[model samples]
Structure formats: structure tokens, C-alpha cells
Target: MKFQLDQPQGGNSISRHDGQHVWVNGRQHGASLLVPWRGEVQDWALARFDDLSEAHFEQILALKPELVIFGSGAKLRFARPALYRALIAARIGLETMDLGAACRTYNVLASEGRSVLAALLIEAA
Candidate 1:
């Protein structure tokens, strides 16, 4: 499947794929596992916090997603133990990766049949 995202002013449009890839202005952005999902792509603004502890929880609360993909910049990091526990409590699945990887994962999951939401912090490339 292919999606056409509107380009922001002075920015390029992002073409998302059902597989593990995203195209920005016709260039592949990243590589990742192709996990298809059934949901909408939710965008949120985040601030600097000690890890993605609250951000994950808040996004889950707001989006009510079956699964959440966190795009934590350019490197993969496990969510804080507290956050993981919270997710478990809420019965929400959580996956963390770098921004690009998260984007790919989001597209994959969205393509499949899982209800997915993404909280990303990546610069446009």
C-alpha cells in the first residue's frame, strides 16, 4: 500500500509504505521489520524528559491504541521500566526504535491489522 502525505511549507512530502520503508521526496528513509497494523497514524509533540516514560503512557491514554511505536531519535532504547510496567497494566503493546525505524514499523503495522499509534521525534530528511 502507498500513502501520500502533504508536504509542509519548505518541506517534502512523505510517501509511506506497507512494508518496512518510507520515502521522502522519492528517497528511501530507513530499514526495519515489516509488521503490519490496522490503525491510524497519530502524531504528538514531545518535550525532553527522562527517557520516554510519560510520553508513552500519555500517548497510549490519548490515542487508546492497541500498540504504540516510539520513535526515539536515531537509536533504539528500551522504555523505562516504569513505562513498561504501565503499558503492561494498561494492556498496551509497546515497541521502541529510532525515528526512521519507528516510521517503517508504523507503516508495516498499519498495513497489517493492528491498531497502532506512533510518537516520533525525527528530523525531516
Candidate 2:
């Protein structure tokens, strides 16, 4: 599926997504990546959900977003709460979903100018 903004959006918005990849503002990316509500896109360096660690969640702390959307590849998976304790302590809300749903949700929250962060994991082929 694809998402389009009726008018121009300031930051990057997910344009399309599927089982294998997600297109950010029309640019195709197959690797895990992070899309902030505002800022440059960056590689996430995660191949699967099991590869997640507390350090990974710590990296997100620097971005300072009010919310986080974690996309667990093609299937819906939940991460251990301990891995994201920093977010909880910092009062940052987190929502977990499949990759496609995360992409769609990111677009909606971002368009509304919310401080949303999307940590999407695209499975390796």
C-alpha cells in the first residue's frame, strides 16, 4: 500500500510498503531504517526482532521523540519491555506493529505534525 499527503509535508513520509521493503517519499529502501518526524533518514542496522537490544533503544533516546513506532518486519511481534525502559522512563510512548501498519501509521501521525519516530525493520532476503 501507498500513502500520499494531500499537500506538501515538511519531513519524510512513507509512500509505499510491502512485505520486503518500504518506500520513503518514493525512495526504495530494503534495509532496516529509522524515519524521524523531522530529520535525515538513517540506517537501523537490525536484521530481525531477535537482534534488538537495549542499546538499540538507547540510540533512539537521542532523537527525543514523543512517540515511537516499531515495525517488526512482515509479522506482528512485540519486544520485551526491558529493552525500551528508557523510553518508558522518559515518558515516550511506543507502539508496535507489522511493517506495513507501522508505515501507514507513521504517515498519519507525521502529517498531523506529531513528533513521531518510526524504527522499521525490513527483513533480509
Candidate 3:
């Protein structure tokens, strides 16, 4: 039962991932999403990196994660500070990287018992 107890709750291992989808605990998500260390997985409505707005970052505040890993689609992209001012003010940690890297790092951190959230944006294949 170790495998079953690995994750603290329903949000366990990310079973699989690809260019267009992510599977958490065997559940497939075809769009960008917010994977937290615990609790529910949220569907992040970011269609593309360029479409990211201040509102999107602000919306993340409601999740109240201690750290946020930003997955900028398949390519690596950075966000402007102005777009994430709320996160700064909240003293939340932020890390930016390509989608693949974000997903991997999120897995490690989450398993280690950290409160991390991965915000992944995937484009059409």
C-alpha cells in the first residue's frame, strides 16, 4: 500500500504527460492546469503564454500556494514582473521554466512534502 499512500491525498503522482496533455492520478487533462501539492487540480484557462494577463496571476492568489512553478508551454518563456505583482506582494515564491521542466520539478517538490503548484500551459499539438 506504499504506492497508494505515497501521495497525501487524491492529488498523487502525475501519471503521464505529453505535448498536449497531462495525467494526474490517472486523470487526463487536455489543457493548461494548476497542480497543487494537495487537494484538487485546477484547470488553468491560459490558452497561450502571450495571453497571460495580470488577472490570471491574480486569480492564482485564491489557491494560496506557497510556491508556484510556471510552465510556459512547450517553449521556455518568462513573464514580466508587472503581470505577477500580486504574487510578489503576497510573498509567494515563483519559478519559471518550460512546461516539461515545470512538471518534473513539481513532481519532486510535491513528493518531498512541499506546498508547490504547477501552472502548466500547453498548446495544440
lDDT, residue 59, candidate 1: 55
| Native-referenced Cα lDDT, model 1 | 0.55
> Which stretches in model 3 have alpha-carbon errors above 4 Å?
1-10
Ranking of predictions according to lDDT: 2, 3, 1
Displacement of the residue 17 alpha carbon in candidate 2, Å = 1.1
Who is ahead in lDDT, 2 or 3? 2
lDDT of 3 by residue, 1-125 (tens): 35446545545567678879988877999998888888888888889788999988887888898999998988888999999999999999999998888888888888878888888888876
Model 3 poorest ten-residue lDDT run: 1-10
Which pairs, if any, clash in model 2? Answer: none
The clash numbers for all candidates, in the given order, read 12, 0, 0
Q: Which candidate wins on TM-score?
A: 2
Ranking by TM-score: 2, 3, 1
Across 10-76, the per-residue lDDT of candidate 1 in tens digits comes to 3333355333345544565443222223233333443333444665475566556688787666666
lDDT of 3 at 108: 85
Candidate 1 deviant stretches above 4 angstroms: 1-43, 49-56, 123-125
**In lDDT terms, which candidate is top?**
2
For model 3, state the Cα shift of residue 48 in Å: 1.0
Query: Once model 1 is optimally superposed onto the true structure by TM-score, how far is the C-alpha of residue 117 displaced, in angstroms?
Result: 0.9
Lowest lDDT block of 10, candidate 2: 1-10
Q: Model 2, range 42-79, lDDT digits (tens) per residue? A: 88878888999998888888899999999988889999
